[model samples]
Target chain A: MIEIFDLEKRYGFTYAIRDINLKIETGEFIGLIGPNGSGKTTLLKLLFGYCRPTHGHIRINGQPPSPKTNSFITFYPEIDSLYGNMRVFRLIDWYSRFFTDWNKETEKKLIEFFNIPLNKYVRQLSKGFRARLKLLLSLSRDADIFLLDEPLSGIDPASRDKIVSAILREYRENQTIIFSTHIVSEAETLFERTIFLMDGSVILDGKSDDLREKYGKSIDTIFREEMYA
Target chain B: MNTMEFERDRPIFLQIKSAVKERIVRREIKKELPTIRGLAVELGVNPNTVARAYRELETEGIIGSRVGKGTWVIPEALQEIRKEMIEDIIDKFLNNLHSIGLDSKEIKEILEGINDRDI
Candidate 1:
């Protein structure tokens, strides 16, 4: 389980997120949703220990977020920071060697599923393929918690479908996944629980089915009508 | 696996339940229902939603499952499902008629007129 207590993050007197508290259980699939500049990325960065919280704290399985805790967590950043000049196959080889728990079978399957061109250099691939490569690298690890930041952003509809399918295919029953995305309509069904973030604060958090039952609307519709409106 | 289209104004598990019932009534699911995980993946939904639908179906005696075997439609599920669907249609029909200011006498007259036409 992961616990957050009165978490806050500030940069130069501006608050990115504040008064945040959440408890994520094992094996739950959660969606962190908000529009751009809502601090979705900042919250994810804090959870992964990319930056320290200015106040409060987070605990993962009774331990604070650190290099030791990070070993069991896999983070897929929204940015493309892979080596631009490296060939895909060579990059995979070099990347896989860093993780002791990397699964070669999963790597092979995702490569085919994403239809990634192994001969192409990272700089030569399209935006969709680059996103797929990042997802592949993150998901190939046997991590207990996967923090995916906008895995579907800026991709074509067909490629988005493929990416969603690959995520489902690799989902283990015991793994906990928290993926942040604003494209709620395309990915709402995958979330068992959803947290709606607005202006750096959580406005809604509940089981997806319960929310649907109460509002008589899909999560996408709820986000639009309640959050955006 | 084909992704199922869902309505935007209903709980997904309820939609899944009706989808399974329609399939059973149509004989598309003759013997065994797909495993919850398999259907969840096929429908692009969470496994818990599918499990809840299956649980409701079991409670309603529409389907049954065993440990080694899989979930299957009950022997009398077709007739029961048909009856339930008829009830739903009748309820909607009555509600629509009531909303349009038609009473039982007027509804009976309309039914009689249709029977007489027989065209």
Candidate 2:
């Protein structure tokens, strides 16, 4: 479980995320959705202990989030964090050394499932292939919490389905996944609960179905009406 | 199995439940329902979602599962299930028709029109 208490993150005088209090239970698939620069990345980074909060605190599994929290939190940043110069197979070998729960069997299966040419350089791959590789690396780890930032963004429609299918196939019963995306229509079906962020704060949070029932429309439509209203 | 599609306007488990209920009513579900894992993969939904769908169906006496035998339609309750489901569909259709300001006579006219068509 992740517990956040009055969480705030500021850059100089400007705030990125403020007054955020959320409690995510175990074994949930949460969708964090919003427009650009809505503090989605900041909130995820704060959860991963990659940046310091200006105020408030976050707890992972009842402990204060620190470097140790990284053990169970597998974070896929929105940016391209892979070493562009490295070959695919070599990169896998290097990354597997960091996580203790790296499953070799899962890695082998995903490697074949994605059908990524292991001999190609990471920089030489297309955007879709890179995202697949990143997902392969993250999903192979037996982590308790997964924070994926826009895993489906900037990919072709065909690759989007493949990526979403891969995630559904590999997700375990014990893990809690929080994925942020701007493409709400495509990703909305997979969400049980959703958090809608706006201007650095949560504007709405609830079961996706309840929201849809209340609005009498799709989550994407509700999101647009809420954000634009 | 073909990939089951879902609409984004409502809960997926409800859609899954309705789909299964439709199959049961149509007698398309013969021996057994698909395994939770199999259906989940086919629909690209969480297994927990499929499990909830099955649990609700079981609660409604539409289906049941036994250990190692997998889930199956309740053959004995098929007639009752059909009655309840048809009633539900009619209720929804009538509600929609009334919501659009149609009275009973107009609804009957529309029903007659539908009956004349090759449905």
Candidate 3:
């Protein structure tokens, strides 16, 4: 379980996120949803320990986020951080050597499913393929928690479907996944719980089905009509 | 299995339940239901949602599962599903008419005015 208490982050004079408290249980698939500049990425960065919270704290399985806790968490950043000059197959080899829990079988399956060109350099691949390679690398690890930041952003609809399918295919029953995305319509069905962030604060947090029952609308509709309105 | 497009206004589990019930009624799913994970993947939904739908169906005696054997439609599920479907249709029809300002009296009058020979 992960417990975040009264978390706050600030950059210079501006607050990125403030007064955030969340408790994520094991095996739960959560959506961190918000528009641009709503601190979705900041919140994910804080969770992954890429940056420290200015106030409050986060505990993963009763331990704080650190290099030790990092082993249990697999983070897929929103940016393209792969080695630009390395061939796809070489990059995969280098990445697999870093983790003892890497599953070669999953790597093979994702490579086939995503149709990634192994001979092409990472910089030479299309945006969609780059995103697929990032996802493949993150999902190939056997980690307890997966933090994916906007895995569907800027991709075509067909590639988005393939990404969603790959995510589902690699989903283990015991793993916890918290993915942040504004593409709520396509991904709404995958979220068991959804947290709606607006202006760096959580405006809504509940089970997806309960939210649907309460509002009589899908999460996407609520996100658009209520949160953005 | 074909991808199912969900209506955005209702709870997804309820929608899934109705869809599965419709399939069972239509004999498209005669013997066994797909595994929760399989159905989840096919529908692009969380497996927990599919599991909830299955659990509700089980509670209603529409489906059953054993340890070794997979989940299957109950023998009398067809009759039970038909009764539920009829109730649902009537409830929806009544609600729709009511929403349009028609009371039970007007509904009954309209029903009585329909010519039997129109068939």
Listed models, DockQ each: 0.61, 0.53, 0.70
Which pairs of residues collide in candidate 3? none
Poorest 10 consecutive residues of model 3 chain A by lDDT?
A: A220-229
Ranked by lDDT from best down, the candidates are 3, 1, 2
For model 3, residues B9-101, the per-residue Cα lDDT tens digits are 678899899899999988999999998888888999888888899999999999999877999999787998898899989999889999999
RMSD of every prediction = 2.2, 3.1, 2.8
Q: iRMS value of model 1?
A: 1.3
Candidate 2 lDDT by residue in tens digits, A13-113: 89999899999999989999999999999999999888989999998999887768899989997798899999999999999998898999999999998
lDDT of 2 at A167: 86
Off by over 4 Å in 2: B1-4, B66-69, B88-119
Model number with the top DockQ: 3
Interface Cα root-mean-square deviation for all models: 1.3, 1.8, 0.9
Stretches of candidate 1 off by over 4 Å are B1-3, B66-68, B97-102, B109-119
Chain B TM-score of candidate 1 stands at: 0.84
TM-score of each: 0.92, 0.89, 0.91
